[model samples]
Target: MYQFPKGFLWGAATSAPQSEGAALKDGKSPTTWDKWFEMEPELFYDQVGPENTSNTYELYKEDVANMKAMNLNSFRTSIAWSRLLPDGKNLNPKAVAFYRDYFQELVDNGVEPIINLFHFDMPWWLMEKGGWEARESVDHFAYYASVAFEQFGDIVKKWATFNEPLVHIECGYYGDAHWPKVHDFKRAIQVGYHTLLAHAKAVAAFRESKYNDGQISIILNLSPVYPRSQEPADLEAAKWADHIYIRSFLDCAVKGDFADEFVALLKEADLAPVTEAGDREIFLNNTVDFVGCNYYQPMRVQAPEVAKRPISDPHDLFAPYDWPEKRINPHRGWEIYPRGIYDIAMRLKESYDNIPWYISENGMGVSEEERFENLDGIIEDDYRIEFIEDHLAELHRAIEAGSPCFGYHLWTFADCWSWLNAYKNRYGYYRVDIKDGFKRTPKQSSFWMADVIAKNGFSREQI
Candidate 1:
């Protein structure tokens, strides 16, 4: 057994919208997700939208019990921002009661709940008011953060300010996948800067709050960006990719500054982040205590002779140019290189002083329907099992070589919802009968995880 350090945190991760259902039952206003799901349900795969998800909102007590059944020591779940404030200010008693009770229930179950403030679900009213692209949205976000921490901080100790700020930029704004879809590189830059400003402000507020037993952090989707080859152009492309993907937020949060080269790129491209005079100083000054890492796969980058402009959907009225480069990942049609995890850790250790980090979100998403069958409902998810084990092995090696990672929280505790993917990409240890009122049935990997948590290590390489 490769013994992990004492008091290592081993649990599963979930976002509120992804796991918690009752998306709009309890006095909750329509977030952008609710609006989108209502307006164009067909936009999602299989026509499965984000209306009523895993029923976690209604079944949280039972869900907590299920976590205990799975031998979880700590659980990661984000708080729905709209749920808390409804309209980011109007107090919703029902939402408060639901979350209060849910968090308390988890605590009673001996499972420490790590609460994140925002998880990709933006309040629709904010969208009408310009969403994340406007300066006011940042203030609104900071206000939401304060409200959440003030209310839940007593019960929830670990608070994630935002779940993957860059993702909300790339997928939501720049890519075609997410809400308020736009492909404006200039807006993307401004939006990223504003989001970081909000994060730093929230972290500062959290430190000032009465909650003393906990810490506040931001979870970023960090990938190990690799050059496609030994060519210098490819290496430069990788560096550019890294700056946009990780360093932009990382340096802002940790060093209280943005990279000069990064700023230069924005200026040279005329896509520099729009910010208030002191925003940079504010973000660089206030730092987080930990990092919530959402590791999916590595990125292979190569310079494009001519990168295309950002692609826009019907929703966005304006657009700008995108990076002049290319990226590829074959496994799963996305990247599947596990060494990215090691590279991320090594970079963090070497550059950022190895600030305390946890793998807040990491797991493999597979089509779960055809995989699980009549073997007493056991999903021989050897593929998923291998994915996690491989990442953990790399993490272990990094730790041995001096990476200050404290814990690992898989992408999910159970299959819930992916903003646009619906139920197509299942990342869960337990399979929920999507039709049977979302009844959760533990997969074969569930027991495997429990044993790993119970013993803190496996007896051998392959269980």
Candidate 2:
């Protein structure tokens, strides 16, 4: 058995909106997600509306109890922006009191709290005003972050400014998949830049706050970038994909500069991310204390003859309607190349000084046939166990190679709510019966994770 260092973090993650159903209560304003559910209910699977979620707002005690049962020594969850500041400006007293109590429960249970500020939840008020694309939203976001830190910083010390910023930029701005469904690359690029700026500003704000043990970070969903072959053109395309997809924000946030090659690429394409006065310095100087990486899969790229294209540019080189090249896992339809985790880890170690870091998320999604067949008990999750073990094995390699790795936290503890999938693509350890008043039950993989965390390593031969 491979042993993890003492005091490693072992737990699961969830967010307020995904788990807490009382969406319209707690003085919460409509988030962009809430609005999405209402405006285009068809976009959601089965048109599952968002009125009632996991109800964590009313069930923190039971959730915490679930954590204890999981043998979790640590837990990660995001605070809903609209919940605390209903209109995205003023603080609601009950909201603050509720979260304070929620966080305190974790502390009381010896569960280390890793609090993320934003997890793809945007206040509808902000979106109505053009969301992150407009400069005003940046300032408004800074204010909202400051408010969150001011109100909750006392109990929640470990904080993340944003979760998977690129996904938001890609899904929200450049693609019509996520909310605000605006498909403008220029807006996407600008919003991407501003998101980084917002992260830096939030980090600065958190530093200024008087929270004990306060640490600020940004969570990136990093996939290992791969070239299909050693051909020169293929390698070039691979590097380009890696730069725009992974390195851009990471270099700026962790290493204090945009990658020179990516910057040159941007310049050559006449697509340098527009920067405001002092934005570069804010990013350069306000490096995050840690990196929270959400590793899922890797990108396998082959050079295509799309010449007028800026590879990795949000602008579609392929027709806007066509999907790009990547191996899709037939089982779940996600690109399931496992080496991405290793490559992502090594990239961070090689380029970003290997800052203290943790794996914030890594999980697999499966069709709901198992659920319909009444086959989703904790014991039947071997595929998930295998998926996690594969990534962790790579992480073990990175750690041995001297990456400043801390620990790992799976995407969720028990079956919690996903944003668009509603209760469909359940990524939880303890499965929550969505119809049973959000009742919780452990999947077999959850118990496997407990053993994995307890033992720290699994081998290929073991399979």
Q: After superposing candidate 1, which stretches have Cα over 4 Å from the reference?
A: 307-331
Best by TM-score: 1
Worst 10-residue lDDT window, candidate 2 = 314-323
Q: 396-433 in candidate 2: lDDT tens per residue?
A: 77777887778788888867767677766767787777
Cand. 1 Cα-lDDT: 0.78
Evaluate model 2: give its TM-score.
0.92
Clashing pairs in 1: 256-284
lDDT of all predictions, in order shown? Answer: 0.78, 0.77
Q: RMSD per prediction, one decimal?
A: 4.1, 3.0
Measured against the true structure, the TM-scores of the candidates, in listed sequence, are 0.93, 0.92
